[model samples]
Target: MRAAGLEPLEPYPGSGSPWCCRHEACGREVTPRLGNISSARQGGCRYCAGKAPIPPDEAQALMRAADLEPLEPYATSMTPWRCRCTTCGSEVSPTLMKVRTGGGCRFCASHGFDLTAPARVYVMQHHQHNAVKIGIGGTAGRNERVNHHRRSGWVLARDWHFATGVEAHAVEQAVLRHLHEAGHGPYLNRDVMPNGWTETFGADLVTPATLAAIGTALLSSLPVTLYCSGSSAGR
Candidate 1:
């Protein structure tokens, strides 16, 4: 125990039993089994191992610095901490470790299609499978979602950029609902298009043009607060 930076607080307990010791570095009382410590299976002190109990005030300050207001008292670092996003005013629960590692509010993340950020709704066609797909994604420069499909043998038939992902997603869902009501549900299995098979449909049942038209009609019907722009078709 001395070699491991711990001083025994009492008489020796059996090797398999819990032994009380004080960590010399952090002065924290920890109960660890001698057998486990001797076998190098467990650390001598949780505090020195970075598992110490964090003061509530310190945890709250860390969350506030990340633009999150805690909705409840702080819990374990690994447990979800309920909070409200100062940026988007959305309720979110994120772990302390995740926050410490630089994760922030999901609703305001640029890569996840922030609701108030620009996004795109797309219609894709798979020539080999005679299928079509409808989806929404961020309108960032890369357009990774669409490019991912292109690499998977799906051609972009049409895509429209909207002021926000909320609008784009609304249009995508409206079009998908129309397809589902018209008896054009998912046609591909997970094996073929593992990433987006749930959004795919048989081209014979509904053409890519039809899907694009539905999306366009829905986009036009949305409130004036939402607006969109056209983009060139294909890859």
Candidate 2:
């Protein structure tokens, strides 16, 4: 994997296309597994996992979730559109597609789907709230590219500090500050065996777990630099 993972490519089948896997972002395209911000008919939904077009037999049960009446001739016989997603079915209701900010996945509860909760706030350094950079980079591929981005000043939402994998670790500075202010530092694993990574990759398709393990293992081997020299802000 090239450090930045960005390279000029000869237009080939899969490799030729830009691998876009972000679901909530604008202008992102879809990949086989990573998902992305695309039409509602793609393979999977970034927001709802792979729940659209649930089986037809189950559509009735799913429809009940939104108090939807029986499927109209145009409606899905089953929940979640009953087919990975029927093309532009729009059979599912706006309430069904409604994305509640927080964990209010109530709409899809009967169908066994869970939606993310609202975003939370974090206390960050001046640079964090006001920095000029907004990205992550840690792995040899996208990770490296994100690291390069940090060279420029940037600020990002606190939750982004972990999932972005830009630093190869999920240590959010705000979370770290919370721990440090209490005079406690987080564990940064640096002694993981090679197999640790292999096991991690098995379930790391989500990406955060993979980057987290590698980051902690790397952190464990590094020396700590204490920057708090001012008066101890009593917990």
Report lDDT per candidate. 0.80, 0.28
> Which one wins on TM-score?
1
TM-score of model 1 vs. true structure: 0.52
Candidate 1, residues 43-116, lDDT tens digits: the string is 99875565678778988988999999999989888666999999989988877877876787978776555667
Full-model lDDT, candidate 1: 0.80
Clashes per prediction? 0, 23
Question: Each model's TM-score?
Answer: 0.52, 0.16
Show the lowest summed lDDT stretch of 10 residues, model 2. 195-204
Per-residue lDDT tens digits for candidate 2, residues 64-150, read: 443444344224321122221133232333223332212112333433211222111121111422211111222223333322333
